[model samples]
Target: MANQREELDGSLSVDDPILSLRNASVTFDEGNSFVLNDVSLDLGRGEILGIVGESGSGKSMLAEAMLDAIPDPGVLQGEIIYRPDSDTDIDILELNKNELRSMRWEQISMVFQGAMSSFNPTMKVGAHFRETIQAHDADVKAGMSRAREALADVYLDPERVLDSYPHELSGGMQQRALIALSIVLEPDILVMDEPTAALDLLMQRSILLLLEDLKEKYDLTMVFITHDLPLVAALADRMAIMYAFDLVEAGPTDEIIDHAAHPYTRALLNSTPNLDAPLEEMRPIAGQSPAPINVPSGCSYHPRCPLADEQCRSVDPHFHDTGEAHGTACFHWQQARDDIELNYKASVSANPNTPARGDD
Candidate 1:
């Protein structure tokens, strides 16, 4: 079935996609549950692409598949082609254990969520730092001196943080350490899964600024995974909105935020608080997200979509190019484009007093 779908769409060309997922599908059991369904995406160098969706939208799962970090008993069918800094492209899913091991920290790095769980309680923060750096460059000295420098790079004091354990450091400090560790190897691309989720507002801003600085200094391409639309708006050059394991909308960040094409994207933006405006101006999207295991037929967001009609309930929609660098997967993309203002006004009207949710 996957092959047939691929044949119909024609395989995504290798030259155009730096990292592409073409007709990708992942099923937990034999036709019992499909986590991902024929999803495709293209990422390029020097670009920061943000993937925004609710908890069960498979955002993290997609990240895992991209890195080939899925455990046994999981089946992934797709082409996750990685174009390294050396100008070599390899299908991550097809790579053997040794090959995968070789690429793990050297070519790509991931800053996963839950900083506490990610670190080893038994190991000192400095030791973990040295170990990670040594894994990539064994010749490089893995001494306290180097580890201290690394700690300082992430705004941590060498003397204090280097000797401290993961549990000893504050949540923000630990997250910064993880960020520091991820870049220690200087991987070409960094996949950050909610890098600021555990941080305070001030720390989140600081971390994002640090990321911007690192990107300029190291020439790194980043994939920032988060559900926060405002954060994406502020940081991402481009953005993709995921719904039920598939991309619902994608475009330049400015265009998507200002003129969202998909209902889900608009709903997401609607849910975000507008600090500059009065509380009465804020609005939240109505209804709950569909269950991934039993995603709604046709449009996955139709159940929660205000404009959903009979057609939306029966027929699935493919991504259609609405403008240059902007696309949406909705049958009413064109109509929605015309009616965006009206829809937004109506949404705001329904929930007149809901203030925009503030950043944590």
Candidate 2:
């Protein structure tokens, strides 16, 4: 019944969470500015956590941070605590390089965006799978079998896909192959960043269903990262809204779709294309996101928020929770929650699963 977890430290509790990112932030160019600021998230066992945000919202950066995949020149701050099961908890951010490498692909795996482009042009699809499986196994023959089984799981013909190169396959096929490879190990947590970014509407739906089946089949926890809210709501049990490098809102998917509290969340939902609405009725969120180097004082979103006040412009907002895990970073969340919901609901689509509306 508690709203905000006020007393709880940012660590992952072994009881529930498979992975927890606590007060996590990312900065680049030698601490010149933060690309991701003061973000915390929890992915529960067997649950899909959707990270919804815009291009500049650092959703991908947060995903990279989770897997300790941030490249050189970027600095990650704070803790990434992970508990693969009930018996152990480890702070991933503090892990040694070797440990990070070994933990990933074995316990956690990532299905990155641009799978079509991600595969090596020179390597055949089968070769790629064999290499991945062989890296962890001494038995090359057994690894190939596992790879074919994974391909079958994703609805791809194991023989055709393995023999083909990435370029030889269709975009969706290449994507499915990449997905097959990621799940070949059956990692406990699958972190997918925009898995359907390249596919058409039909393929997107196919991938979505494939993901649902994979989660249930493998008993996996999932973190789905994308700029698409409706897509996330379609499969995710819980959702988080990220903006200006901060996690502004976290709640149930339905609540976020129907009763979002943060201004950014409201504006995002309002701006999203309502498939149920004609093109003429659609309206986009006004104002642009401030540059990471030039983030605004106080509430970073105050400039675009219609409900902004003197307090909003000058004093930063902290999250105010509604129940247990649902909360928003907004000074006027209590006052604006109902009005925002009413106004947006009147103008927006109720169904979050409505397929692509094309960005505004």
Best by TM-score: 2
lDDT of 2 at 69: 88
Top model by lDDT, which number?
Answer: 2
**Over the stretch 82-185, how does candidate 1's per-residue lDDT look in tens digits?**
88644677899889988887687667889999889889999988788777766565545544455566567677787777688988988888888888777766
**Candidate 2 lDDT, tens digit per residue, 1-360?**
011333442221223888877777788878877888867677788888889998888888898888888887889987888887668889887788888887788888999999976799999999988887777763778778888888888888899889988888888888888988987877888889998888887788778778888888888889999887876787888888888887888877777777787878877766667565556555577889988788888888899988999998887776776664567878888677766643333423234453432111
Candidate 1: worst-modelled 10 consecutive residues by lDDT: 351-360
lDDT against true structure, model 1: 0.73
Runs in model 2 with CA error above 4 Å? 1-15, 341-360
Q: What is the C-alpha lDDT of each candidate?
A: 0.73, 0.78
Candidate 1 shows a clash count of 1
Distance from true location, Cα of 175 in model 1, Å: 0.7
lDDT of 2: 0.78
